[model samples]
Target: MAPSTRRAYATGERSFTCYCQSMNRSPWPASSDLVEDYVTHLFNTGIASSTLSVYLSAIARYHVMHNWPDPTQSARLKAILEGARRMNGVHQDQRLPITPDLLRQLHSRLHLTSNQHIDQRMFGAAFTLAHHFLLRVSEYTSISPARFNPDATLCLDDVHYDRTMLRCTIKQSKTDQRRNGVTLTMQRAESPFVHDVCTGYSEIRRLLYPANFPFFMHASGRFLTRSDVTEALKKCLPDSCDRMRYSSHSFRIGGATAAAADGQPVDAICKKGRWKSASFQRYIRPFPNT
Candidate 1:
Protein backbone atom coordinates (compact mmCIF):
# COMPACT_ATOMS: atom_id res chain seq x y z
CA MET A 1 0.00 0.00 0.00
CA ALA A 2 1.07 3.59 -0.54
CA PRO A 3 1.98 5.80 2.41
CA SER A 4 -1.38 7.57 2.29
CA THR A 5 -3.25 4.27 2.23
CA ARG A 6 -1.16 3.07 5.18
CA ARG A 7 -1.97 6.19 7.14
CA ALA A 8 -5.71 5.88 6.41
CA TYR A 9 -5.73 2.22 7.36
CA ALA A 10 -3.88 2.99 10.55
CA THR A 11 -6.41 5.67 11.35
CA GLY A 12 -9.34 3.33 10.73
CA GLU A 13 -7.75 0.61 12.84
CA ARG A 14 -7.10 3.08 15.62
CA SER A 15 -10.72 4.23 15.58
CA PHE A 16 -11.94 0.64 15.71
CA THR A 17 -9.52 -0.17 18.54
CA CYS A 18 -10.69 2.80 20.53
CA TYR A 19 -14.31 1.86 20.00
CA CYS A 20 -13.61 -1.71 21.04
CA GLN A 21 -11.81 -0.52 24.18
CA SER A 22 -14.75 1.65 25.13
CA MET A 23 -17.12 -1.24 24.65
CA ASN A 24 -14.79 -3.68 26.49
CA ARG A 25 -14.54 -5.86 23.36
CA SER A 26 -11.40 -7.29 21.76
CA PRO A 27 -10.59 -5.50 18.51
CA TRP A 28 -8.52 -8.38 17.25
CA PRO A 29 -10.46 -11.61 16.91
CA ALA A 30 -13.63 -9.61 17.47
CA SER A 31 -16.92 -11.46 17.04
CA SER A 32 -19.17 -10.79 14.05
CA ASP A 33 -21.88 -9.57 16.44
CA LEU A 34 -19.45 -7.10 17.99
CA VAL A 35 -18.35 -5.87 14.56
CA GLU A 36 -21.96 -5.36 13.50
CA ASP A 37 -22.64 -3.47 16.71
CA TYR A 38 -19.65 -1.21 16.14
CA VAL A 39 -20.71 -0.41 12.59
CA THR A 40 -24.26 0.22 13.71
CA HIS A 41 -23.02 2.45 16.51
CA LEU A 42 -20.89 4.46 14.09
CA PHE A 43 -23.64 4.62 11.46
CA ASN A 44 -26.12 5.96 13.99
CA THR A 45 -23.64 8.73 14.77
CA GLY A 46 -23.95 9.91 11.12
CA ILE A 47 -20.65 8.51 9.96
CA ALA A 48 -20.59 8.21 6.17
CA SER A 49 -20.99 4.59 5.12
CA SER A 50 -18.04 4.98 2.75
CA THR A 51 -15.82 5.91 5.68
CA LEU A 52 -17.18 3.02 7.71
CA SER A 53 -16.20 0.79 4.81
CA VAL A 54 -12.56 1.85 5.23
CA TYR A 55 -12.66 0.95 8.90
CA LEU A 56 -14.05 -2.46 8.04
CA SER A 57 -11.46 -2.95 5.31
CA ALA A 58 -8.72 -2.08 7.76
CA ILE A 59 -10.13 -4.62 10.21
CA ALA A 60 -10.23 -7.23 7.45
CA ARG A 61 -6.67 -6.44 6.40
CA TYR A 62 -5.50 -6.62 9.99
CA HIS A 63 -6.99 -10.07 10.39
CA VAL A 64 -5.39 -11.27 7.16
CA MET A 65 -2.00 -9.94 8.24
CA HIS A 66 -2.38 -11.71 11.57
CA ASN A 67 -3.39 -15.03 9.95
CA TRP A 68 -6.75 -14.85 11.67
CA PRO A 69 -10.26 -15.34 10.32
CA ASP A 70 -11.50 -12.15 8.68
CA PRO A 71 -14.44 -11.03 10.77
CA THR A 72 -15.57 -8.60 8.07
CA GLN A 73 -16.36 -11.61 5.83
CA SER A 74 -19.39 -12.36 7.95
CA ALA A 75 -22.63 -12.23 5.97
CA ARG A 76 -24.36 -10.40 8.77
CA LEU A 77 -21.70 -7.67 8.80
CA LYS A 78 -21.86 -7.40 5.00
CA ALA A 79 -25.62 -6.90 5.17
CA ILE A 80 -25.15 -4.19 7.78
CA LEU A 81 -22.60 -2.45 5.57
CA GLU A 82 -25.01 -2.61 2.64
CA GLY A 83 -27.75 -1.26 4.86
CA ALA A 84 -25.51 1.60 5.99
CA ARG A 85 -24.72 2.37 2.36
CA ARG A 86 -28.42 2.37 1.46
CA MET A 87 -29.21 4.62 4.39
CA ASN A 88 -26.41 7.16 3.93
CA GLY A 89 -25.62 6.93 0.20
CA VAL A 90 -23.24 9.53 -1.22
CA HIS A 91 -23.61 13.24 -0.55
CA GLN A 92 -21.72 15.52 -2.90
CA ASP A 93 -21.51 19.30 -2.93
CA GLN A 94 -21.16 21.15 -6.22
CA ARG A 95 -17.90 23.15 -6.26
CA LEU A 96 -17.65 25.90 -8.84
CA PRO A 97 -14.44 26.30 -10.79
CA ILE A 98 -12.48 29.56 -10.81
CA THR A 99 -12.60 30.52 -14.50
CA PRO A 100 -9.95 32.62 -16.27
CA ASP A 101 -11.91 35.86 -16.09
CA LEU A 102 -12.46 35.27 -12.39
CA LEU A 103 -8.72 34.65 -11.93
CA ARG A 104 -7.96 37.97 -13.62
CA GLN A 105 -10.46 39.61 -11.30
CA LEU A 106 -8.71 38.02 -8.31
CA HIS A 107 -5.38 39.53 -9.38
CA SER A 108 -6.92 42.94 -9.91
CA ARG A 109 -8.89 42.90 -6.67
CA LEU A 110 -5.85 41.83 -4.63
CA HIS A 111 -4.07 44.94 -5.96
CA LEU A 112 -0.95 42.95 -6.85
CA THR A 113 1.46 45.69 -7.78
CA SER A 114 5.04 46.90 -7.13
CA ASN A 115 3.99 48.51 -3.85
CA GLN A 116 2.69 45.20 -2.47
CA HIS A 117 5.21 43.03 -0.61
CA ILE A 118 5.73 39.35 -1.45
CA ASP A 119 3.25 38.45 1.29
CA GLN A 120 0.44 40.03 -0.72
CA ARG A 121 1.93 39.00 -4.04
CA MET A 122 2.10 35.38 -2.94
CA PHE A 123 -1.66 34.81 -3.34
CA GLY A 124 -1.88 36.13 -6.89
CA ALA A 125 1.22 34.21 -7.95
CA ALA A 126 0.11 30.97 -6.31
CA PHE A 127 -3.42 31.31 -7.70
CA THR A 128 -2.09 32.07 -11.19
CA LEU A 129 0.32 29.14 -11.18
CA ALA A 130 -2.28 26.66 -9.99
CA HIS A 131 -4.64 27.83 -12.74
CA HIS A 132 -2.09 27.97 -15.55
CA PHE A 133 -0.17 24.90 -14.47
CA LEU A 134 -3.20 22.78 -13.37
CA LEU A 135 -1.47 22.29 -10.02
CA ARG A 136 -2.96 20.68 -6.97
CA VAL A 137 -2.72 23.06 -4.04
CA SER A 138 -0.88 20.30 -2.14
CA GLU A 139 1.76 20.10 -4.90
CA TYR A 140 2.82 23.68 -4.21
CA THR A 141 1.96 24.16 -0.55
CA SER A 142 2.79 22.13 2.54
CA ILE A 143 0.41 19.43 3.85
CA SER A 144 -0.65 21.78 6.64
CA PRO A 145 0.56 24.90 4.72
CA ALA A 146 2.28 26.24 7.87
CA ARG A 147 5.28 23.83 7.63
CA PHE A 148 7.83 23.00 4.91
CA ASN A 149 8.19 19.84 2.80
CA PRO A 150 11.14 20.01 0.40
CA ASP A 151 10.27 16.54 -0.89
CA ALA A 152 6.87 17.70 -2.18
CA THR A 153 6.23 21.45 -1.97
CA LEU A 154 7.39 23.91 -4.62
CA CYS A 155 10.82 25.25 -3.68
CA LEU A 156 12.26 28.46 -5.11
CA ASP A 157 14.71 26.50 -7.22
CA ASP A 158 11.93 24.38 -8.68
CA VAL A 159 10.66 27.36 -10.70
CA HIS A 160 12.59 29.09 -13.48
CA TYR A 161 11.77 32.03 -15.76
CA ASP A 162 12.93 33.92 -18.83
CA ARG A 163 11.54 36.64 -21.09
CA THR A 164 9.31 34.39 -23.18
CA MET A 165 8.22 31.67 -20.73
CA LEU A 166 8.18 30.38 -17.17
CA ARG A 167 8.93 26.76 -16.24
CA CYS A 168 8.06 24.89 -13.02
CA THR A 169 8.81 21.48 -11.55
CA ILE A 170 6.27 19.68 -9.40
CA LYS A 171 8.40 17.29 -7.35
CA GLN A 172 5.50 15.26 -5.96
CA SER A 173 1.82 14.59 -6.71
CA LYS A 174 -0.85 12.13 -5.63
CA THR A 175 -0.89 10.40 -9.02
CA ASP A 176 2.87 10.01 -9.26
CA GLN A 177 2.99 7.07 -6.87
CA ARG A 178 6.44 6.09 -8.09
CA ARG A 179 7.90 9.41 -6.88
CA ASN A 180 8.94 10.42 -10.40
CA GLY A 181 9.26 14.19 -10.87
CA VAL A 182 7.01 16.14 -13.26
CA THR A 183 7.64 19.50 -14.85
CA LEU A 184 5.10 22.07 -16.14
CA THR A 185 5.97 25.01 -18.37
CA MET A 186 3.93 28.01 -19.41
CA GLN A 187 4.90 30.73 -21.84
CA ARG A 188 4.46 34.12 -20.16
CA ALA A 189 0.99 35.53 -20.69
CA GLU A 190 0.08 39.06 -21.84
CA SER A 191 0.91 42.02 -19.54
CA PRO A 192 -0.26 41.02 -16.03
CA PHE A 193 1.47 37.60 -16.05
CA VAL A 194 4.87 39.16 -16.65
CA HIS A 195 4.20 41.82 -14.03
CA ASP A 196 3.19 39.25 -11.40
CA VAL A 197 6.23 37.04 -12.00
CA CYS A 198 8.65 39.97 -12.13
CA THR A 199 7.27 41.54 -8.98
CA GLY A 200 7.46 38.26 -7.05
CA TYR A 201 11.04 37.62 -8.26
CA SER A 202 12.19 41.11 -7.28
CA GLU A 203 10.99 40.54 -3.73
CA ILE A 204 12.43 37.02 -3.28
CA ARG A 205 16.03 38.14 -2.77
CA ARG A 206 15.06 40.89 -0.31
CA LEU A 207 12.81 38.50 1.64
CA LEU A 208 14.06 36.23 4.46
CA TYR A 209 13.56 32.94 2.58
CA PRO A 210 16.57 31.32 0.97
CA ALA A 211 16.87 29.76 -2.52
CA ASN A 212 15.92 26.34 -1.04
CA PHE A 213 12.73 27.65 0.55
CA PRO A 214 9.15 27.32 -0.72
CA PHE A 215 8.57 29.50 -3.77
CA PHE A 216 5.51 31.15 -2.19
CA MET A 217 7.07 31.83 1.19
CA HIS A 218 5.35 34.61 3.08
CA ALA A 219 7.28 37.66 4.27
CA SER A 220 6.70 36.42 7.81
CA GLY A 221 9.06 33.43 7.13
CA ARG A 222 6.21 30.91 6.68
CA PHE A 223 5.13 29.21 3.47
CA LEU A 224 1.81 30.64 2.21
CA THR A 225 -0.67 28.22 3.78
CA ARG A 226 -3.81 26.69 2.20
CA SER A 227 -6.05 28.63 4.59
CA ASP A 228 -4.32 31.85 3.57
CA VAL A 229 -4.74 30.97 -0.10
CA THR A 230 -8.44 30.08 0.37
CA GLU A 231 -9.04 33.28 2.31
CA ALA A 232 -7.38 35.31 -0.41
CA LEU A 233 -9.39 33.59 -3.14
CA LYS A 234 -12.65 34.02 -1.24
CA LYS A 235 -11.88 37.72 -0.74
CA CYS A 236 -11.44 38.34 -4.46
CA LEU A 237 -14.31 36.18 -5.75
CA PRO A 238 -16.96 38.14 -7.64
CA ASP A 239 -20.04 39.03 -5.60
CA SER A 240 -22.24 36.68 -7.67
CA CYS A 241 -20.14 33.64 -6.94
CA ASP A 242 -20.54 31.76 -3.67
CA ARG A 243 -17.12 31.67 -2.06
CA MET A 244 -18.12 28.78 0.15
CA ARG A 245 -18.68 26.59 -2.93
CA TYR A 246 -15.05 26.76 -4.07
CA SER A 247 -11.61 25.81 -2.78
CA SER A 248 -7.94 25.57 -3.88
CA HIS A 249 -8.99 22.71 -6.19
CA SER A 250 -11.33 25.02 -8.09
CA PHE A 251 -8.35 26.64 -9.82
CA ARG A 252 -7.21 23.39 -11.42
CA ILE A 253 -10.69 22.52 -12.64
CA GLY A 254 -11.37 26.07 -13.73
CA GLY A 255 -8.23 26.15 -15.83
CA ALA A 256 -9.08 22.87 -17.50
CA THR A 257 -12.65 24.01 -18.16
CA ALA A 258 -11.51 27.33 -19.58
CA ALA A 259 -8.95 25.59 -21.76
CA ALA A 260 -11.60 23.26 -23.13
CA ALA A 261 -14.01 26.12 -23.69
CA ASP A 262 -11.26 28.01 -25.55
CA GLY A 263 -10.85 25.00 -27.88
CA GLN A 264 -7.72 23.48 -26.38
CA PRO A 265 -7.58 19.78 -27.31
CA VAL A 266 -8.47 17.20 -24.67
CA ASP A 267 -5.14 15.43 -25.09
CA ALA A 268 -3.30 18.72 -24.63
CA ILE A 269 -5.26 19.50 -21.45
CA CYS A 270 -4.63 15.95 -20.24
CA LYS A 271 -0.90 16.32 -20.89
CA LYS A 272 -0.75 19.74 -19.28
CA GLY A 273 -2.57 18.44 -16.19
CA ARG A 274 -0.38 15.27 -16.18
CA TRP A 275 -3.46 13.09 -16.04
CA LYS A 276 -2.65 9.57 -17.28
CA SER A 277 -6.32 8.69 -17.74
CA ALA A 278 -9.49 10.26 -19.13
CA SER A 279 -10.51 10.99 -15.54
CA PHE A 280 -9.57 14.60 -16.28
CA GLN A 281 -12.91 14.86 -18.07
CA ARG A 282 -14.69 14.97 -14.73
CA TYR A 283 -12.72 18.01 -13.62
CA ILE A 284 -13.88 20.11 -16.56
CA ARG A 285 -17.33 21.01 -15.33
CA PRO A 286 -19.61 23.12 -17.53
CA PHE A 287 -18.36 26.70 -17.55
CA PRO A 288 -21.10 28.98 -16.20
CA ASN A 289 -22.60 31.52 -18.63
CA THR A 290 -21.77 34.35 -16.24
Candidate 2:
Protein backbone atom coordinates (compact mmCIF):
# COMPACT_ATOMS: atom_id res chain seq x y z
CA MET A 1 0.00 0.00 0.00
CA ALA A 2 1.07 3.60 -0.56
CA PRO A 3 2.34 5.60 2.41
CA SER A 4 -0.76 7.76 2.20
CA THR A 5 -3.00 4.71 2.50
CA ARG A 6 -1.17 3.54 5.60
CA ARG A 7 -1.51 6.99 7.19
CA ALA A 8 -5.26 7.10 6.48
CA TYR A 9 -5.67 3.60 7.94
CA ALA A 10 -3.74 4.67 11.01
CA THR A 11 -6.03 7.66 11.45
CA GLY A 12 -9.07 5.40 11.21
CA GLU A 13 -7.63 3.14 13.89
CA ARG A 14 -7.05 6.10 16.18
CA SER A 15 -10.63 7.32 15.78
CA PHE A 16 -12.01 3.85 16.56
CA THR A 17 -9.84 3.55 19.65
CA CYS A 18 -10.92 6.92 20.99
CA TYR A 19 -14.61 6.24 20.40
CA CYS A 20 -14.36 2.85 22.16
CA GLN A 21 -12.66 4.47 25.17
CA SER A 22 -15.34 7.12 25.53
CA MET A 23 -18.07 4.49 25.37
CA ASN A 24 -16.34 2.17 27.91
CA ARG A 25 -16.37 -0.71 25.42
CA SER A 26 -13.69 -3.11 24.20
CA PRO A 27 -12.56 -2.28 20.66
CA TRP A 28 -11.32 -5.79 19.90
CA PRO A 29 -13.49 -8.10 17.82
CA ALA A 30 -16.13 -5.39 17.61
CA SER A 31 -19.71 -6.68 17.72
CA SER A 32 -22.03 -5.71 14.87
CA ASP A 33 -24.20 -3.61 17.21
CA LEU A 34 -21.20 -1.71 18.56
CA VAL A 35 -20.01 -1.04 15.04
CA GLU A 36 -23.48 0.14 13.96
CA ASP A 37 -23.65 2.54 16.91
CA TYR A 38 -20.17 3.75 16.02
CA VAL A 39 -21.31 4.70 12.53
CA THR A 40 -24.24 6.56 13.98
CA HIS A 41 -21.96 8.41 16.36
CA LEU A 42 -19.75 9.58 13.51
CA PHE A 43 -22.70 10.60 11.34
CA ASN A 44 -24.14 12.64 14.21
CA THR A 45 -20.80 14.42 14.50
CA GLY A 46 -21.12 15.66 10.89
CA ILE A 47 -18.75 13.13 9.39
CA ALA A 48 -19.38 12.48 5.71
CA SER A 49 -20.87 9.11 4.79
CA SER A 50 -17.71 8.34 2.84
CA THR A 51 -15.56 8.90 5.93
CA LEU A 52 -17.93 6.79 8.03
CA SER A 53 -17.09 3.85 5.75
CA VAL A 54 -13.38 4.41 6.30
CA TYR A 55 -13.79 4.26 10.05
CA LEU A 56 -15.75 1.02 9.74
CA SER A 57 -12.95 -0.37 7.60
CA ALA A 58 -10.43 0.40 10.35
CA ILE A 59 -12.56 -1.48 12.87
CA ALA A 60 -12.93 -4.40 10.47
CA ARG A 61 -9.16 -4.54 9.90
CA TYR A 62 -8.54 -4.88 13.63
CA HIS A 63 -10.88 -7.88 13.86
CA VAL A 64 -9.38 -9.61 10.83
CA MET A 65 -5.84 -9.27 12.13
CA HIS A 66 -6.82 -10.84 15.51
CA ASN A 67 -8.36 -13.93 13.87
CA TRP A 68 -11.93 -12.74 14.31
CA PRO A 69 -14.73 -12.43 11.75
CA ASP A 70 -15.14 -9.09 9.99
CA PRO A 71 -17.96 -7.32 11.84
CA THR A 72 -18.34 -4.97 8.87
CA GLN A 73 -19.85 -7.94 7.00
CA SER A 74 -22.96 -7.70 9.16
CA ALA A 75 -26.04 -7.00 7.11
CA ARG A 76 -27.31 -4.48 9.68
CA LEU A 77 -24.13 -2.40 9.47
CA LYS A 78 -24.25 -2.41 5.66
CA ALA A 79 -27.87 -1.24 5.77
CA ILE A 80 -26.92 1.60 8.10
CA LEU A 81 -24.18 2.70 5.68
CA GLU A 82 -26.63 2.58 2.77
CA GLY A 83 -29.24 4.58 4.71
CA ALA A 84 -26.73 7.23 5.71
CA ARG A 85 -25.40 7.48 2.15
CA ARG A 86 -28.91 8.03 0.80
CA MET A 87 -29.68 10.62 3.46
CA ASN A 88 -26.42 12.47 2.79
CA GLY A 89 -25.71 12.50 -0.90
CA VAL A 90 -22.14 12.27 -2.09
CA HIS A 91 -20.46 15.67 -2.58
CA GLN A 92 -18.19 15.96 -5.57
CA ASP A 93 -15.87 18.93 -5.97
CA GLN A 94 -15.83 18.92 -9.74
CA ARG A 95 -13.14 21.40 -10.83
CA LEU A 96 -13.42 23.14 -14.18
CA PRO A 97 -11.24 21.95 -17.02
CA ILE A 98 -8.28 24.09 -18.24
CA THR A 99 -8.80 23.92 -21.99
CA PRO A 100 -6.02 24.80 -24.42
CA ASP A 101 -7.09 28.43 -24.45
CA LEU A 102 -7.02 28.75 -20.67
CA LEU A 103 -3.58 27.15 -20.61
CA ARG A 104 -2.30 29.74 -23.06
CA GLN A 105 -3.75 32.48 -20.89
CA LEU A 106 -2.00 31.07 -17.83
CA HIS A 107 1.31 30.95 -19.66
CA SER A 108 0.97 34.47 -20.99
CA ARG A 109 0.60 35.84 -17.44
CA LEU A 110 3.65 34.09 -16.02
CA HIS A 111 7.11 35.78 -15.80
CA LEU A 112 9.60 33.52 -17.49
CA THR A 113 13.26 34.20 -16.73
CA SER A 114 16.60 32.42 -16.12
CA ASN A 115 17.65 34.20 -12.89
CA GLN A 116 15.00 32.97 -10.42
CA HIS A 117 15.10 29.74 -8.45
CA ILE A 118 11.64 29.01 -9.90
CA ASP A 119 9.63 30.86 -12.52
CA GLN A 120 7.21 30.66 -15.46
CA ARG A 121 9.42 28.44 -17.51
CA MET A 122 8.99 25.82 -14.81
CA PHE A 123 5.21 26.29 -14.73
CA GLY A 124 5.06 26.43 -18.52
CA ALA A 125 6.97 23.19 -18.85
CA ALA A 126 4.82 21.41 -16.25
CA PHE A 127 1.53 22.67 -17.69
CA THR A 128 2.47 21.93 -21.27
CA LEU A 129 3.72 18.46 -20.38
CA ALA A 130 0.61 17.61 -18.38
CA HIS A 131 -1.60 18.93 -21.17
CA HIS A 132 0.05 16.82 -23.83
CA PHE A 133 0.86 13.73 -21.74
CA LEU A 134 -2.28 13.45 -19.52
CA LEU A 135 -0.26 13.19 -16.29
CA ARG A 136 -1.59 13.14 -12.74
CA VAL A 137 0.18 15.81 -10.69
CA SER A 138 1.42 13.19 -8.25
CA GLU A 139 3.19 11.41 -11.11
CA TYR A 140 5.34 14.45 -11.78
CA THR A 141 5.40 16.40 -8.52
CA SER A 142 6.38 15.62 -4.95
CA ILE A 143 3.49 15.67 -2.49
CA SER A 144 5.76 17.12 0.18
CA PRO A 145 9.28 18.35 -0.38
CA ALA A 146 10.52 16.26 2.55
CA ARG A 147 8.82 13.11 1.28
CA PHE A 148 9.94 12.97 -2.31
CA ASN A 149 10.54 9.53 -3.86
CA PRO A 150 13.30 9.74 -6.42
CA ASP A 151 12.21 6.52 -8.13
CA ALA A 152 8.55 7.46 -8.39
CA THR A 153 8.76 11.18 -9.00
CA LEU A 154 9.91 12.56 -12.34
CA CYS A 155 13.67 13.05 -12.28
CA LEU A 156 15.79 14.74 -14.94
CA ASP A 157 17.15 11.34 -16.02
CA ASP A 158 13.66 10.14 -16.97
CA VAL A 159 13.33 12.62 -19.84
CA HIS A 160 15.04 12.90 -23.20
CA TYR A 161 14.58 15.35 -26.07
CA ASP A 162 15.86 15.72 -29.62
CA ARG A 163 15.27 18.29 -32.33
CA THR A 164 11.88 16.80 -33.20
CA MET A 165 10.49 14.80 -30.32
CA LEU A 166 10.34 14.38 -26.51
CA ARG A 167 10.21 11.07 -24.66
CA CYS A 168 9.27 10.66 -20.98
CA THR A 169 9.55 7.40 -19.05
CA ILE A 170 7.50 7.18 -15.90
CA LYS A 171 8.81 4.69 -13.35
CA GLN A 172 5.33 3.94 -11.95
CA SER A 173 1.78 5.25 -11.93
CA LYS A 174 -1.30 4.79 -9.73
CA THR A 175 -2.69 2.08 -12.03
CA ASP A 176 0.54 0.29 -12.87
CA GLN A 177 -0.03 -2.37 -10.19
CA ARG A 178 2.84 -4.63 -11.22
CA ARG A 179 5.38 -1.79 -11.01
CA ASN A 180 5.96 -2.34 -14.72
CA GLY A 181 6.50 1.21 -16.01
CA VAL A 182 5.56 3.09 -19.19
CA THR A 183 7.23 5.35 -21.71
CA LEU A 184 5.26 8.07 -23.52
CA THR A 185 6.47 9.78 -26.69
CA MET A 186 5.22 13.18 -27.85
CA GLN A 187 6.17 14.37 -31.29
CA ARG A 188 7.15 17.98 -31.98
CA ALA A 189 3.85 19.82 -31.68
CA GLU A 190 2.55 21.92 -34.57
CA SER A 191 2.57 24.86 -32.20
CA PRO A 192 5.97 25.97 -30.88
CA PHE A 193 4.71 26.73 -27.36
CA VAL A 194 5.13 23.19 -26.03
CA HIS A 195 8.63 22.69 -27.40
CA ASP A 196 9.94 26.10 -26.38
CA VAL A 197 8.72 25.97 -22.78
CA CYS A 198 9.85 22.37 -22.26
CA THR A 199 13.31 22.95 -23.71
CA GLY A 200 13.63 26.21 -21.78
CA TYR A 201 12.77 24.52 -18.51
CA SER A 202 15.17 21.73 -19.37
CA GLU A 203 18.03 24.12 -19.97
CA ILE A 204 17.39 26.00 -16.74
CA ARG A 205 16.93 22.75 -14.83
CA ARG A 206 20.35 21.43 -15.85
CA LEU A 207 21.98 24.64 -14.70
CA LEU A 208 20.50 24.44 -11.19
CA TYR A 209 20.12 20.71 -10.53
CA PRO A 210 22.24 17.61 -10.87
CA ALA A 211 20.99 14.94 -13.27
CA ASN A 212 19.36 13.04 -10.36
CA PHE A 213 17.26 15.89 -8.91
CA PRO A 214 13.60 16.50 -9.72
CA PHE A 215 12.75 18.40 -12.91
CA PHE A 216 10.48 20.95 -11.16
CA MET A 217 12.41 21.74 -7.98
CA HIS A 218 11.27 24.59 -5.78
CA ALA A 219 13.15 27.79 -5.01
CA SER A 220 13.67 26.49 -1.48
CA GLY A 221 15.66 23.61 -2.99
CA ARG A 222 12.78 21.24 -2.26
CA PHE A 223 10.36 19.35 -4.47
CA LEU A 224 7.22 21.27 -5.47
CA THR A 225 4.09 20.12 -3.63
CA ARG A 226 0.56 19.85 -5.05
CA SER A 227 -0.31 22.93 -2.99
CA ASP A 228 2.54 24.72 -4.74
CA VAL A 229 1.13 23.75 -8.13
CA THR A 230 -2.45 24.83 -7.21
CA GLU A 231 -1.36 28.19 -5.79
CA ALA A 232 0.74 29.00 -8.86
CA LEU A 233 -2.14 28.01 -11.16
CA LYS A 234 -4.61 30.16 -9.21
CA LYS A 235 -2.34 33.19 -9.30
CA CYS A 236 -2.14 33.13 -13.10
CA LEU A 237 -5.86 32.49 -13.74
CA PRO A 238 -7.27 34.79 -16.43
CA ASP A 239 -9.22 37.67 -14.88
CA SER A 240 -12.68 36.57 -13.63
CA CYS A 241 -11.78 32.88 -13.70
CA ASP A 242 -13.00 31.21 -10.50
CA ARG A 243 -9.93 29.89 -8.73
CA MET A 244 -11.94 27.22 -6.94
CA ARG A 245 -13.15 25.75 -10.23
CA TYR A 246 -9.64 25.06 -11.48
CA SER A 247 -6.96 22.82 -9.97
CA SER A 248 -3.84 20.85 -10.85
CA HIS A 249 -6.21 18.32 -12.44
CA SER A 250 -7.42 20.92 -14.93
CA PHE A 251 -4.44 20.11 -17.15
CA ARG A 252 -5.39 16.45 -17.57
CA ILE A 253 -9.05 17.24 -18.06
CA GLY A 254 -8.25 19.99 -20.54
CA GLY A 255 -5.84 17.81 -22.48
CA ALA A 256 -8.43 15.08 -22.91
CA THR A 257 -11.12 17.61 -23.71
CA ALA A 258 -9.00 19.43 -26.31
CA ALA A 259 -8.23 16.15 -28.05
CA ALA A 260 -11.90 15.17 -28.10
CA ALA A 261 -12.94 18.58 -29.45
CA ASP A 262 -10.40 18.13 -32.24
CA GLY A 263 -12.02 14.81 -33.22
CA GLN A 264 -9.29 12.58 -31.85
CA PRO A 265 -10.40 8.95 -31.59
CA VAL A 266 -11.58 7.83 -28.17
CA ASP A 267 -9.08 4.97 -28.16
CA ALA A 268 -6.27 7.31 -29.06
CA ILE A 269 -7.18 9.65 -26.26
CA CYS A 270 -7.37 6.70 -23.88
CA LYS A 271 -3.95 5.48 -24.97
CA LYS A 272 -2.37 8.93 -24.73
CA GLY A 273 -3.81 9.28 -21.23
CA ARG A 274 -2.63 5.75 -20.28
CA TRP A 275 -6.17 4.88 -19.25
CA LYS A 276 -6.83 1.14 -19.32
CA SER A 277 -10.61 1.45 -19.80
CA ALA A 278 -13.44 3.79 -20.77
CA SER A 279 -13.12 5.51 -17.39
CA PHE A 280 -11.28 8.16 -19.42
CA GLN A 281 -14.72 9.15 -20.77
CA ARG A 282 -15.50 10.66 -17.38
CA TYR A 283 -12.36 12.77 -17.88
CA ILE A 284 -14.10 14.43 -20.90
CA ARG A 285 -16.47 17.12 -19.71
CA PRO A 286 -18.09 20.57 -20.52
CA PHE A 287 -17.83 19.18 -24.03
CA PRO A 288 -21.02 17.77 -25.53
CA ASN A 289 -21.81 14.10 -25.16
CA THR A 290 -21.66 12.13 -28.37
TM-scores of all predicted structures: 0.68, 0.69
Task: Per model, state how many residue pairs clash.
Answer: 0, 0
Please give the range of 10 consecutive residues that has the lowest summed lDDT in model 1: 111-120
What local lDDT score does residue 81 receive in model 1, on the 0 to 100 scale?
79
| Local accuracy of candidate 1 as per-residue lDDT tens digits, 145-248 | 56677888888788877666677888867556446888877665644564455446535633566778788866666676677778778777778887778898
C-alpha lDDT values of all predictions: 0.76, 0.77
User: Which model scores highest in TM-score?
Assistant: 2
Candidate 2's displacement at residue 288, Å, is 12
Per-residue lDDT of candidate 2, residues 33-97 (tens digit): 88888888988888986677666666666676677887887888878877887888866648777
